[model samples]
Target: MTAVFDTFYADDTLVDHLTKSIQYSIQSGGKRIRPLFLLETLQAFGIPISEAHFKVAAAVELIHTSSLIHDDLPAMDNDDFRRGQLTNHKVYGEAQAILAGDALLLDPYLLLSSADLNASVIVALVAELAYASGSHGMVAGQVLDMDGEQHTLTVDQLKKIHALKTGRMLTFPFVAAGIIAEQDDEIVALLRQLGEAVGQAFQIRDDILDVTATFEEIGKTPGKDVVADKSTYVKLLGLDGAKQALTEYLDIASQMLTEIEHKTQLQGEPILKQIERLRID
Candidate 1:
């Protein structure tokens, strides 16, 4: 991935500066969970890892990085730090940061379009990615989250927010893999459910960490939810109740994975192990 970004641009000074900003954003270490999820889903289907798969994975990361850059803007979360480093807008000017994010978001479509895969597969991937990242998905979640600030949110409302904001993107890898591997609609539906469950658990853990983990421990500003007065599992459920919710989502995710494994008779241990690591306790 670093190599891809290294040669992502040419020698013009202005272009070089812009590319550098994008590179800096990508080079900053993250969990890389989204791409890993895609790869693992492919592996479970016994699909050979190919350059196309890597391209798809890179596309996913680019979209995620773009979101982070935008999310940290002064108009948004206004976060000054991410992944234990200064936020992009803090390092680069806000205009550059915004453009960089916009560039990153659009580049993925170019990648997917040019990938050496069947037209059908590429089309399916593009459609799913657009829906996941667009208004009905992550954007919707962010709007709801922003709107819910300074006001208490019901449990169902909170779940709906996370489900759109976090869960849709998390679920993309699995659904994309199923599309590439030509899985049936029933299997694809199951993968979507599993993705939703895992996404909910993932967000709950994030809420728990906000209250319980330190900045150094979590690699981002801690307790910002409270400071921002954003509605989160911790704010609504308390620490113990939020934790209980995490367990329930994890259990649901695990059960769905087991069902997928049994139905497909595939070795799902790799993905299952990843879910196990999400346990808050």
Candidate 2:
């Protein structure tokens, strides 16, 4: 993945700073959960790991990293650190960071289009990525989050926010795998449900960590949710309650994976195992 990112640029002289910024953001340490989900989904379908798979995974990572860059800007979370290192805006100037993020966001389409796959597959992937990352998805969640700040949000409101902001991107991997495999609509729908459960669990865990974990443990500033007065599961439910919610979501995700495995008779336990890694207790 690092090698793929490092060599992704062309005509470096004209866009050296942009190239470096993008590389720096991608190289920053992360769990690479999105790409892993995509790969694992493909593996569940018994699809062999191929260059096309790598390309798709890398594109997913690119989109995720791009969102992180923008999310750390002064207008957003306004954080100084991410992934245990200085945020991109802190290292590069804010303008450069913004441009780097923009480049990252747009470059994934190019990567997908250039992949060695059928035109229809490429089109489906591109459309899914766009909807997941665009105004209708993660971006919408961000807007709602910003708006909900300082104001208390109901459980339904909070879930709706996260379903867009975080859930949509997470759903991309499973849905994309189904598309690539040419699975029927029913199978793709099941995958989306599983991904949404995982995504919600993931975000709830993040909220828990914000209140419980230290900076070193989380790799970013902890307690920002409180400081920002943002609505969160931890803030709405008590810490114990939030933990319980996490467990429930994890169970839902696991059960969804189990059903998919039984229905398709596919090796989905690996994906279930990945979801288990998110458990806080």
Candidate 3:
């Protein structure tokens, strides 16, 4: 994944400082959960991991990184640090940071198009990624999140917000894997369902961590959601309730994996292991 990013920015045509700023943000530490989930899903589908698969995973990570860069800007979370380092805006100035984010966000399409895959598969990945990260998906969720800061949000409302924001991006990896593997529509649908369950579980765990984890534990400022009065699973549900919600989502994910395996006779243990790793305990 790092090699993919390094090679992408190695071109001499890009401006020096702009390229440096973008590289700095991409190179900064992150869990790389999106790409990891993606690659794992492909493996579960019995697809041999190759450079083309890596490119698709890299595209997903690029989008995630762009979202993080923008989310930490002054107009958003206004954080000074991310991943225990200065936020992109803090290090590169807001203008350059915005440009860096824009590049990351837009470059994924180019990366996807260039991947060594069938045109139809590449098209599916591109469309799914765009919708997942665009207005009806992540952006819509971000709007709901900001609005929720102004007033209390019900549990259902909070779920809807996250379903679009966090869930869509997380869900894309499974869908992309199915596409790359040329699975039947039924199997692809099951993968999407599994992805959604994992996505929701991931968000619930994050909400729990925001309240409980230390700066070192989370690699960022702790309690920012609480400070901003943002609606979260923990805010709507009590701590125990939030944990229960997390468990329920994980169970759903597990069930989906079972269903997929039963239908396809393919082992889903790799994806299940990735899902289990999200559990705090």
Tens-digit lDDT track for model 3 on 1-281?
Answer: 89998888899998999999988888987888889888887787777899988999999889888889999999998999898899999988999999999998899999988899999999989999998999979888888888889578899998998899899999999888888888999999998998888889999999999999999888889999999998899988889999999999999999999998898856788778888888766
The CA lDDT at 191 in model 3 is 89
Error of 1 at 98 (Å): 0.6
Model 1 clash tally, residue pairs: 0
* Over 4 Å off, model 1: 7-14
Per-candidate TM equals: 0.97, 0.98, 0.98
RMSD (CA, angstroms), candidate 1: 1.4
Residue 154 in model 1: shift from native, Å? 0.7
- Candidate ranking under TM-score, highest first, comes to 3, 2, 1
TM-score of 3: 0.98
53-109: candidate 2 lDDT, tens digit per residue? 888989989989999999999999999999999999999999999999999899999
lDDT of 2: 0.91
| Model 2, position 57: C-alpha lDDT score | 89
Tell me the lDDT of model 3 at 250.
Answer: 97
